[model samples]
Target: MTTNSIALFFMTDFSIPKPNHNKALKTLAPPSLAGKGAGGLGFSPLIALAAILLNLAPTPAIATTVKIDRWSTTSDRVTLKVKVLNNNRIPILGLEEQAFRVKTKDKFGNPHTLQSPEIRVLSPEESHPQQTYVAILLDMSGSMKQKDTARVKKLDGAVNAIRGFINLVKAENLPVDISIIPFGEGCNHSYQVTTKTIEDNFKSASNSELEKQLDELAKVPVCAATNIYQPLTETVKYLRNRFPPSPSEIDAQDKPLPKLSVILLSDGFHVYRNNEPQQFENVINLLKQNSQITVHTLGYGESLAHLRNRAICFKYIPDDRLTVDDVANGCRLPGSDIQEFIVDEDRLKKIAQTTGGIHEFPEDAEAVAKSLKTFFTTLREYEIIYQQPGSDRATIHPTKIEINSPDRGINTLQSETENIRMSNFIYRALTFTQRLPLLILTVFIGLVGVLPFIQWSKKLKQQSDL
Candidate 1:
């Protein structure tokens, strides 16, 4: 087909550049587009039309492009990246099926596809089609100084678990983006210390550097006040900006919004001022109202019990505390006879349940490692694609996402998904008062409706006076 005719299908009011035109079309077309003698100046109209039709024909339907990311932990949880490409190495978008299938050998050595019903689909785009953001929030409070054993510290436990989680995510071999945010008295607002750096520096850093940072985390003394709201608010703000409202607000379809998954870690109570609860509630309620982000909280110590209980009151946690003995172990240092090292595991569990996150208290290095492994593995298995009805700027649209799996002897799972479906809602920038024309019309209508009744009442009063 002529380049002009080919351009019609691919371009809208905004046109693709001439240089990239061929590449874009090739990425979308079937193999027939590459056939010999398909393009020529002297070809008959009929021949040209036939060639064009053949090129436009869809490819044989098989499996859809499903983006997959894997994450794990070493000393803490690590965010994993997974990108799915076609044979031409171009990123695929909105695949027919976006679920992750694990191929493992059973005892007989036969490969089986472990069909995990949970799958998440990302928005479609030519470049960076698969965008994923996983946030690991580590709690670095004084309670983390507790001792697990004579030789190892509780901080050591936290580091080991986080490190192991990171290692697992790296093994997944997907085009994934990762971020790490560590919180204690308050989240490290400094750019150098926050997880936002992961978008740029995480993948490039050597394993040694990653370990160095984790080691230094212990030496950094915990601040006195444990303001969980600050970090939580910061995390929500970052994700909202990162994801934006929708395609229209974003200005271009080529830029797909990143899927946000927050993993929070804390070992202290949320000491917000009396007014702070309302502010925290507003922020969280705004996030829940949007249906675009999923938050998972991990509580680490006995101090966290209060925070966990309060967090659960809001139904934000799915499970209880993700405590590591190393945090308690760190408190029992030599010559420091501190008997109260173990954190309240029950409280931690409640926090996890409220936030819909996994709660576990790992006693040693091995258990910590295994817990990290499970957490990452579950993340890799579950998948979701956000489907809001209108523009991201619409702000108040109800979002509904349907997860489907045909092979696992399941026909439908929508209802079950809804009850456990995490809130991804956000508030629109414009409030009801700002859209005042409608408000004015309603006021006018109310006045009109009440004016006749007032007039009738006045006439009756005058008649009675007569």
Candidate 2:
């Protein structure tokens, strides 16, 4: 045997099967005598140690996977949960919470600035929340029946988005129960797909059943007018009815309130019940009052402002009196048809803002699917601790947050200013609470001063009578 082959045979454990066994053996003696016969096999203990060192060396730019799970805020402070998949081999070692930029989009699609979110990674790291409750409110108004392209309709895109969520739930095996409520003219509660839950240990049969229910929602007929308020209002009531108003219900249940999320898809405004368009604002405010709920609204086609403007034009002028040239040139719309297909943007914004939810406007049918995926990313678990913005808690506050990771491509998440229930101590900051102690001291001082005055008056009156 050659000197090199002899050295290699000794260095490696030849008894262990490896790719080069035959070639090494062919150049040497048979296995039975090779260890004993190959002239001292030139093996050193250092050689084995060197091989292990090479394997342990670090690679270039250690890859990182950061996912934004869930984010929430008090009226002032923002907290973010960022799931860092590779915590052991983090690319940006010692990354701080201040390294991210967080912002929220307005009804105009403009992202307003906010403070950087404080980041926290949950212990015993997880990719998904243990459980979730989703209410998918789909709009089945007459406008949804309109064709997007020659072949695709708006409802087709909505179904695709629903299918995307179903596939996501199955792939992740998330324990989520979904309720689908289709609304137009009024909500068809009978036609609604009630809650379907996926157990902790996932079952294929359960998944198939959920998929079948989604298919049913896809087949609901399109109806005239839009009752945008009913589905949202009813779904909230349904959720409340499921659980009684007891603290123990939240504290004792395994998944208790399991993160309520409402995904509302609408093409236009509330015109079906014409007298109460303003009622939507009240319903949205009610959603905001419930701390457990977060509403994500997706607007399809034109902006709500554009739709409302067209409706206003039609309300003032009758269609029969308008000229065809005026309609073609954009001078005036056929007032008769304007309110039938309008979207109230300001009311939608109010709902989202009060509930710490997101509002998205996707211009085309295809964009709807993409936006749904983005919304799904928000349904994760992580926590952040940061200084609360010192603002008046009694009134709604204007909050702005921003998070950025320097020297990395990690995108900043949206932050919001909404109602965050304060503790008894922190609650003292709101309204008359701060001035309470001072007011009490003032009253005590006044009582002491008035008592001395009364005693002096009584002594003087006694001397005069004597």
Candidate 3:
């Protein structure tokens, strides 16, 4: 048929969602003569049909809301804190191992499928099965002496806040070994809280004694300056010593090594003496090097903007070493010799981010306690253990993780795909040597069954001959 005839037929037959198709034709046609009606202007219905078809066509699937609360890789396994939300944005509970699949890709986009990854849904009420080691690092700079509107000193409020954290941990029955580290000027080993000190105090002390110890910790005199860097190195070293070199080491040693988490309370200032820039570099490097250590920074007493701006400089120092040139470039204004006094939030955030931890700046001491308590509640997260197949452990790999409802077929709403880069890459080879015991057991069982069958057959044949 001719194009004009087809257009005419479509225009006459098609219906439009309006006063009428004739009115739609009038609207589509440009007004040249006011007297002209809908019949004179030619309008085609094919355009509307094409538009409907375009709208109806399938589009790319949207990712459901999901939060990767924390993730870390080790010599033998990758651990993740994943929270999947449904369409209503609530955390979905009771996910099994079969609900998740992990895909690790090298820099070149080569996919490495893990043998089996474990997934456990965390319950906010219950404590995690693994033992936990926590070191609470309290900043004792002079500014911490300032009181809020409630007439309570900052230091006192912080101590009270931490007391609540300890109480919550105890209530949850989390097997936690706690340490309180106080940092400031001119305080050598005199006022520092070490893991040994906490363990020693708790070993013989009752609950009331523990409270007394906390009071003693809170009473540490505030110093003129803050030395966040040195304390961090100490805390990380202490926590790392608690963890085994590999996950398998925990099994081999037959001891429960606790997971390490550091809760640092600071006024969001890094005012260390002597090479302040280098101190920042050291802290950042320490966190990056120890990926297993989770550092949560709680900043109070300053505007978050001030805290966040100071933190941006940390992005420049990817490694431990900080040259004058690096500082001049990172911390100073472009083409200006004058250096800007920066806040410490950015670096603090980077430390938390790299270690799969979190940073928060609460408004008050009460808020601080509440946030810490909330954090402790979410500590019970699922663990996924998968066998690594690839040999390349040096390069960073991009990982895409998927979670689903295992038995709910076809219509199940998948969790949002998590795209993250894997750090602290450790390669574990899956070799036949590890399976020797199983092989031996299987062979021995087979031989025993065969020998019994042969004996029975011989006895039956002898009976028949008789």
In terms of TM-score, how similar is model 2 to the real structure? 0.49
Off by over 4 Å in 2: 1-128, 149-151, 186-206, 243-250, 253-256, 272-278, 304-341, 383-466
Candidate 3 lDDT score at position 47: 57
- The TM-score values for the models, in the order shown, are 0.43, 0.49, 0.52
Q: If both were scored by lDDT, which would come out higher, candidate 2 or candidate 3?
A: 3
Best by lDDT: 3
Q: What local lDDT does model 3 show for residue 171?
A: 73
As a whole number from 0 to 100, the lDDT of residue 31 in candidate 2 is: 65
Worst 10 residues of 3 by lDDT: 2-11
Give lDDT tens digits, candidate 2, residues 1-466.
2111101112334374333322321234556655542244444456557776665564323214444334444444444455432322121223344654434433333545443343333331243354667777888787776654334677778888877876776676667767656666633423333332212212332357556665775676665556667668777766666543433223334333456778888877665444564686679667766756778888766553333333323232233444222222232334344433344555566676676566777756677886786566556544444434443343323333344443433355334443332222333234687689889999999999999999999999999999
lDDT score for residue 103 of model 3: 65
Name the 10 consecutive residues with the lowest summed lDDT in model 2.
1-10
Model 1, C-alpha of 51: deviation from truth (Å): 72
Per-candidate alpha-carbon RMSD to the true structure:
25.5, 23.2, 18.4
- Ordered from best to worst TM-score, the candidate numbers read 3, 2, 1
Evaluated against the true structure, the overall lDDT of model 2 is 0.53
State each model's CA lDDT, in order: 0.45, 0.53, 0.57
- Candidate 1: segments with Cα more than 4 A from true spot: 1-129, 148-152, 186-208, 219-225, 247-251, 273-280, 302-366, 381-412, 415-466
Residue-level lDDT for 199 in candidate 1:
42
